[model samples]
Structures are given as structure tokens and as C-alpha cells.
Target: MTRTLVDPYSVPDELRPYLQEVVQRTHALCGSDLVSVIAVGSVALGDYRHGRSDVDVTVVVDGTAPGPVVPELAAALAHPALPCPAAGLELVVYDRNFTARPSGEAGYLLDINTGPLLPERASVDPSESPAFWYVIDRSVALQAGRVLYGRPAREVIAEPARADVLTALRASVREHSSGEGHLADNRVLNGCRSVQFCRTGRWQAKRRAAEAVAASEERFRPLLRAALHSYERPSRTAATTLPTTDVHTFLAWVAERVDESSDADRRG
Candidate 1:
């Protein structure tokens, strides 16, 4: 039942209501302006964790909505009022061009970041955000996004390909490795997934990627396990066992792997 609307259903009964609300609200706000509503990230990958993972969604419109419309939609869909059953609903609105193509810059109409795990914020300015996460999210959306409304995902979204992903991975690893206020568990698991992506050029769930890497890279098993343990738990302090020093090392290694992959990709 969880996988009905899309492949490999991950949404449980508890999450269905909240997920439905997101679709309904977006339709209500955007109306005929809405081009597509695609579900991305953990939920699309069948790795969604209730109270842990975000129900990431992307809304594609023909063009920019009325300025006030975006703000209203953001307020309408954000936490407390709508009550995201999962950790939160991360819904981003993009024009058809942005949704259909990959850009190296942060170009979005609206970003609603809400949930208990995250600070509540509905950002309309793309200049205030980084481009890497958006690019990565777009790539995932291109490959795996499930259409919640409007046109099919493939018909509307364009592929960002492997090269774009590796570049984005490099940028992300660099930031998480040195940037302040990043989650340690996220760094480790993301490292595992990035390394796997570098090696295989395939995208997958963080838990799946970590498991695959742990099976092959014996040296990082303990760290991966710690990260996986923390990711599975809903508590904020779940990463207590995740070593800070090792996480930096892992990110560095992942950065190097991304570099190698990037170089190889360029050569080929």
C-alpha cells in the first residue's frame, strides 16, 4: 500500500494523510499554474523513516506564480498549520525550465523547510541558499521523482546526469567537512553514499549505499554502522556514538573519491 502512487512505496498509513495534504494544498495554491508535483528523496527511494526522514516534494509550475501566492502556499504548507506527519515536508517550487533542466546555481521559487528536526523557515530567496543541495535534489528528482499531480515526471524533468552529480557531491562534501552546524551522522552516511556513487555512478538510498559500502570497505563498517544507527533513530542526540574525527576523515575520503570520479569522467 505504501508504494501504490509510486514505485517501491515507502509511505506508511500514518504518513498518507500528511502526504495527501501536501498535494491538495499545492493544487489549491498553484491551480492551473501547476505543471507537476513530483515526490523525491527518501520517500521515492523507499527508505523513508517516519519522524526521521523528510517527505521531499517538488512542484513545477509553468512560470513564476504571483509573488504573494508563493508566500501564501509556503505558510499554508509549513508545519503546525498543516502538520507534517513525517519529520517535515520539504516542498520546493520550481518553474518548468528549472524543473526540466539542471543549473549550477540556486534557482527556486519557494523553499518550505519545516519539521521538528529542522527549524521552521519558508525561504523565497534562492540567493540565500547554497546551489549544491538544490542541484543534488534536482538530479534525484530527475532520476527518481514520482509525479504526485500534473504531468509524468519523465515528461517534465530532464536528466542532470553523472557529471553534474559528482560535481555537486564534491561541493557538498567540502561544505559538510568544514561547515559549521552540520550533522555528524549525515556526514558519515552521505560519505558512504557519495563514495558508492563515485564508484558505481548510481544513486540510491543512504542506508542502502552505506550497507553496500560496509560490505566492501571493511575499514569503514563501524563508522557506517554508527551513522546508520543514528539515522534510524528519531532523537537529536542519536549521533553520540558517531565519532567526529572519523566523520571528517570519511568526508575527506569521499571528496577524494569524488575528485577521482570527476577526473575520470572528464577523461572519458
Candidate 2:
């Protein structure tokens, strides 16, 4: 059953039609089991630069849905004509029951990832990566997440503990800090945003966060500027101009700062 596709609300024009189809398809396939479809990450925040950001989403399903729903949604999303914009689609689907009681459960039924790094894949089991938790946490799923169907975003996801968010941020910094080339730029800019969020309980768009931190902090200006440039031209490593050694140094510094902040948060 193919659901009709219409322009989705609050979605960027580039991916709206495609995402609309994807969401509708999921609805048709899952029927009564479907709970909600949500847009998250850069797309939800309105900072999705064409050719640079991936379309990220979260779909919720009632617990009674059959186990095969994972693969079904993956197949529903893989439209040949509507190829994933930059970096492909990063999607996660959760069971309504699991989300309602997030403390003990692994929080998702399907984790579908497809992009430059790997072919389209869907895992029925939860991922060990901090990113999985990053999405499940309220920061991405509730604060920035936009509902495409069903319940309101806040009702679909639980408000995560502050400690959980801090833990995820620290782990993300540790993992991304080792990246080089274009990834180095991502690590730097994302580090600034994560740090800013940790310091002040507010979340801002990546480039805006970098600009705000650079303007007030002077020391991070050059690196943040280079990161913003690299973010725009992700394919051109040379355009970043910052040496690999410098990127590593900056990453290490950012990691240390995040650790210190996390420790302080825990203590306080």
C-alpha cells in the first residue's frame, strides 16, 4: 500500500517530497502499528546545507508490530529516484513501549544507515555507538525533533537525564576527535557545539554555535572559521588550510575541555 506523498511540513524543500513519500510509505506498511514519524538532526534544525547534511529521522511503532517491520521500513525508504541528499539517510525507529520505559531497554527496533561510508543497512538490534543514544536522548529526539505524524514529539520521547546527555557528548567527542581531512572539520565544529551545549543548556545550529564561540573566545576563531569553510566545501581537504597536525591538536584540546566540563557537571 503506497500512501500519497505531499509536501512535508517544516522540511527543507530539497528533501521534503522524498521524505514525505518515505513517511507515508511507512504509515501504509505499518498501518495501526505506526505511532509517529519524526525529523531530527540538521534537517529538523533548518541548517541542512544541500550536499553537506544527511536526512535524519526517527519513526515510532507500537510494540505489537511484527518483528519484520524493520526491514520493511528500510525497503520503503530506499527510493531509487529520491536518493539521500548529502551523506545519505540516517534513520532510527523505536518501539513505543521501549521509549516509554527507556531506562532498561535499548531504545530502538531498526537503525538504518546509508551514505558515503557504507551501503544501505538496517540493524534489528541496537547499536553500541554513542550516536544511537545521542538520537534516543531528548536533546535530538525531543528538543530538536519535529513530528511528521502521530503524537507530539515530547509525548513520543522521554526527557533524558542531564547526566545521560553529558555522557553522550563526552563519548561523541572522544570518537570524533580522531577523524582527519573533512571529518576533522566536522569534529571541530561539532565539538564547539557540544561544548557550548554542555556549558549552557542551549542547543544552537552548528555554524551558529561555531560563530558565537569564536566571536567571544578569540582562541577558537581561526579553527572555527576553517571548520565552517570545510563544512561548506566538504570535498576539499586542501581548502581547510589547517594542517593535519593542527587539527589533531585542536581535537585533543577540545576533548580535554569536554572531559573537564563533564567532570565538573558530575561534581556539581
List candidate 1 stretches off by more than 4 Å. Answer: 1-10
| Residue 179's lDDT in candidate 2 | 67
Q: Give TM-scores for every candidate, taking all chains together and pairing residue i with residue i.
A: 0.91, 0.87
Task: Pull out the clashing pairs in model 2.
Answer: none
What lDDT tens digits, residue by residue, belong to model 1 across residues 1-268?
Answer: 1222342244566776777677777777777887887888887676777766778888889988888898889888878888877766788888887766756766888988997677888888999988778888777777777777778777877767677777789888988897476678877777877887787766789999999988998888899888888888875555465677888877887888899989988899
* lDDT tens digits, residue span 1-268, model 2: 5543332657887777667777777887788888888887887777887767777888888885686766777776763434665567877777887776434234567877776643667777665544534443446767887777777668868766666666677777667765632366777778777867777876677888888778877766787888888888844334455567766776677677768877887788
Give the RMSD in angstroms, all C-alphas superposed, for model 2: 2.9
**What is the model-wide C-alpha lDDT for candidate 2?**
0.70
Kindly provide the TM-score of model 2 when superposed on the true structure, using C-alpha atoms.
0.87
TM-score of 1: 0.91
lDDT value, candidate 1, whole model:
0.78
Computed on alpha carbons, the lDDT of every model, listed in order, comes to 0.78, 0.70
